[model samples]
Target chain A: MPHLDILKAAASSNQWMAIYPELLLGSLALVLLALEIILPKKQHAVIPSVAIIGQIGVLIWLAFNFHTVFLKPEHAYTFSGLLHHSEVGQFMRVFFLLASILVCVLGTIALAKQKMPRIEFFHIVLVVSAAMMLLAQSNNFILLFVALETVTVGFYILVSYFRTNPLSLEAGLKYLIMGALSSGLLLFGIVLLYGVAGNPTLPGSSANPMDFTALHTFLLANPNNFLASIGIVLVLSGVAFKIGAVPFQIWIPDVYQGAPTPVTAFLAVASKAAGFSLLLILTQNVFTPYEKLTTPVLAIMAAATILFGNLAALTQHNVKRLIGLSGVSHAGYLLIGVVAAGSQPLAIGAIYFYLFAYLLASFAVFGVMTHVAGGDDADQDLAHYSDLAKTHPFLGAVLAIGLGSLAGIPPLAGFMGKLLIFVAAFKAGLHVLLVVAIVGVVISIYYYFGWIKAAFFETWRAPLLEGETDLRPMCTPVGIMAGVALAMLALATVVLGCYQGAFGDWLLALKF
Target chain B: MADLIFYIFAAFTAGSALAVVLTKNTVAAALALLLCLVGVAGIFVLLDAFLLAALMVFVYAGAVVALFLFIVMLLDVQGGVRKPFKKATIVSSVFAFILLLLGLASFAHKGVQTTGDLGAAAPVGATLKSYGEQLFTTYLLPVQIVGFLLLIAMLGVIVLSKKFEGLEDIK
Candidate 1:
């Protein structure tokens, strides 16, 4: 060993200690995989619980101890600058772990719908969850892109989990083409950004932070540069594609319509939340100057996204398509926070709060969809939901709460999430955007209620003169999901509105 | 001087990529893409990262593209006969051309970092040694991860394609 290098090793115990959460989760993933194969098939279900425990423990560990890591952002010791060990990273790490557990339970419950195997599904969920966790907290662009791909490749498999279902295949194709396009755009933009960074006459501070802190400083130091602006747009486009934002959201409806209900819920909620987390970290760290320059572009996209999501949703009779469009509209709302960025912390905070609300609500709503329409997860028509409330009051009630929350109705968590976002937007001097956001919120109520009415008001009518069909049978497991839904809605009532600080701290601690 | 060479090779890569996309025949497209891959390698070489360029060719062209061609031929997805340019294609191509021009114009003004580290360019052996060291010391976990992924994929494919004793073969 070089004599001076020995001193470098002796100097950095804290650096090794910084990323203990990621290390623990990673080791736990391997242990879970091994345990899955070793454990008896009957009790293999316990594996996910074990994984969740490991994940939650990391969060608890971080919440108690990671503030010091956050304070010492410069103390990362990794493959050059590949992994950033920070409190913000530790915080976002929790999302990946928690979301994975949610997905595993939801997916395992949903597997009963199609009678698919659980072990592989659970294994893949954990793997995909690990990838999402890795991607969200990534500081380097190369690592970020790779992590996104890792999550998505697993997603492709999950989308097509129902092999015999033609609709599932269709959804898979749409996701693939659109995902590839977004990735191509992302790669091209990365190459260009590399070019811009390559030509510096002076050596950079701290060996190219490839992470957000360095990237943000670089972009901000030279504000007028078009490459930085264009790069930011390209990166945002990649994320928008993931979250199903407009212009990039053309693939969403088809995927939602075709995929298993649990998969759609996963896509719309947790996966989309991961995209929000990525955007949050990136905007906060990498494109701090993007506020001054790219505000107009974001404003236009946000306005269009809200308008398009609403107008398209109103015409859709398919419950899946409606929910899909609903997800897109919410993305438009989240973009308001993205637009506000570092200039308004509360706006970004609102985006994070809204993600939690949206995820829980979507899961509950899709849970009801799985319950009532026990077909091939393809029958998402309002007609399918016509007689739901009559037979299954609990499911209907859960559906109502989900739809109401999604529509931003007061006293529900979604409404509080939106109100906080509105306040944030106002702080950012986005009056026009705020008014449009409110209008978007109001218009959403009409569409969301339209479905609720169908769920609640199910009077039998004489068969249509032209054609007739039999409604599918509702399944028993779906009833179980409805129970999960009721629990989530009840939790949202007080958990989000009253104790806003609980989620607010978790979301805001995301800033690097 | 190196930048000029890099630009030349990069244009070659860009042109080759365009040719790959434009080709009507699948075989021709694959061939054009091969050229594009090689040109990208050359661009890497010109960037003073000779080892990376060599690795690009060795891994990308030698393994990935060869696998791609094999799968392309296996699938028999005909590129179909050439037709007159559709309005959408024209709009897309025009948009692409405009983007290219804008990119070039902006790139000319950008500050690029160039290194005069030509002598440091390692051969296949030395390059392998360094790459191995880097992967092991720095990216050991991610590297190990890629290996596990390969193992899983192999097991999955075996499961998918293998036959059973009692089940009637569908084919």
Candidate 2:
């Protein structure tokens, strides 16, 4: 029968080996759950270590096998065209793994203080990381939606893991509502595009329009199609919510302040990176025909995001909220790189470098926040950080370096990251956005410096009454694992800054 | 006949959807939502998407609405007094309203350009067999990934709700 033959052919193309990392991660997640059930209570502490080490193993294996299919002249369509694997996809897989390992490291410290289920947090992180890997390489919209939903649903539970905290619960509820709304918008856009592109009368329309290449061909044939343009804009808007761009950034501060610190870092770094990688793929490849519509929308959002993020971060005493808003500004800067990627190839590498810089600096800063945070996870404040350097020099130094890099200070990785993007933006003749980004960088320095000053230099305050006790949460002493992670992050930040080396060249030289 | 049925179901869905939003009583609103889903299923049937229509009715109208009713009844949630809109809310809503108008106007003007003859090629999700075959074959990866999604979601529910009898040990 033709049908049986067709099924056999399609089934034969399901290459499970191409996604070994994701498969290994999913298996590891299940193993963690099984171990939790089997191991006695005292031995449960080893579970987080397993998650971290297993992820590192995956990362090592990935690195060793990097050139197995790296920079192939053509993209590899695996799993029957559901995934389009390229060198960029490989890079993102590595990025997500690194981010997950750090989050797990921070999760141990953060979870130690909380009276919550610890094993589940690690399980969710692994599954979410695996999902993000698939999301980055999704060739079909079905896989994209499925992978994205897995990540988002994992976050909903992870966000509210500390259910004892009312703030955490509130953040979870807000995220659920807002996330559902964004997904609705994205689904509407996808349905619209799918409907429009499958119309047989349309030039270059495809039988399978959900595939990115198929949709790209349809879009190329109908560059000015109205429904297609609307769909593109709506999809971009949904992604904007994930990256915390202006107008879609209302949920950031509350969610950040209320979420446990490590999860906040995950949202700030990994989730944002996932969105940008998908955005890069979408705009650079699938949506290229709609550049006329996308470029202006992105440019405007970038400008607004930069101004809003910096301005809002000012006047925030809550350190988590402050970092969260600053992250918004970083998203703005990345948006500039994304817009410029249309005209400048260097912008792609610049964007990835910036994300790597962000991952390192953000995890460094958040690792410190995890140590500084006390029992009430939601109430971390800038005042609590006063005299931090005098008390704990290591954390204070890490904080200063992280913040300085974030502020684009020279000889720091963030400085190099920002410089590369600015150069690309200049080459793209986005002079207006370039100016907006500069002003944003200057404004961001003020708040970042404010944080640094709070840590390093003590400001005068009224003496406490005899009955009043100090409310500041005492900084937790660094553990061996956390210390190593933070030190590695800080060193990487400094080293990558001084020398981009062959790594930078490889990233710049990547095909889309 | 099909066009008439499509219009009727479409109207029914839209009207009940509006009721679901506007109604003050929680149970009444939920019932309206059920009607909305049924109407959507009806429209799906008119469009020759029998499997989707049945699944919509079965999964959403059957299971989900029942779950909603159980929760609503168990909580006995009263419709509290509505707060007045804040300045930001009002301003943003107004801006959103204008944008919606512009979007609707543009869609009305230009969305109808695609007047394609419906092709003989069968739609992917039109039947249970084809859907199952596709799910187990070409779309196997997504299906497996979705399994993980549900697994985590289940774990999340337990993590979020399970009472900690051994809190000390957990810590």
DockQ winner? 2
lDDT tens digits by residue: candidate 1, A1-512: 67446445433432444456655655776687688578765676577567656666766776677566445645653545566655545555665665665666566556665545444555556666666766665777767776677677767767777766888878887887888899988877776566565434423422343555566666666676666667778888888899888788899889988877777877888788888888777767677666775677767888888888988898898888888988898989988888876577667667777877776677667767766656467776787777678777777777887887788887778888888788888888999988888888878888899898887885576776666666446545444533654566556654675676655776754555
TM-score of 2: 0.98
Work out the TM-score per prediction: 0.86, 0.98
lDDT of 2 by residue, A409-507 (tens): 989999999999999999999999998999999999999999999999979878999999888898999999999999999999899989999999998
RMSD of 1: 4.5
The docking category that best describes candidate 1 is acceptable
lDDT of 2 at A6: 82
Docking level of model 2: high
CA lDDT, every prediction? 0.70, 0.93
Q: Each model's DockQ?
A: 0.24, 0.81
The 10 consecutive residues of candidate 2 chain B with the worst lDDT sum are B113-122
Model 2: per-residue Cα lDDT at residue A355: 97
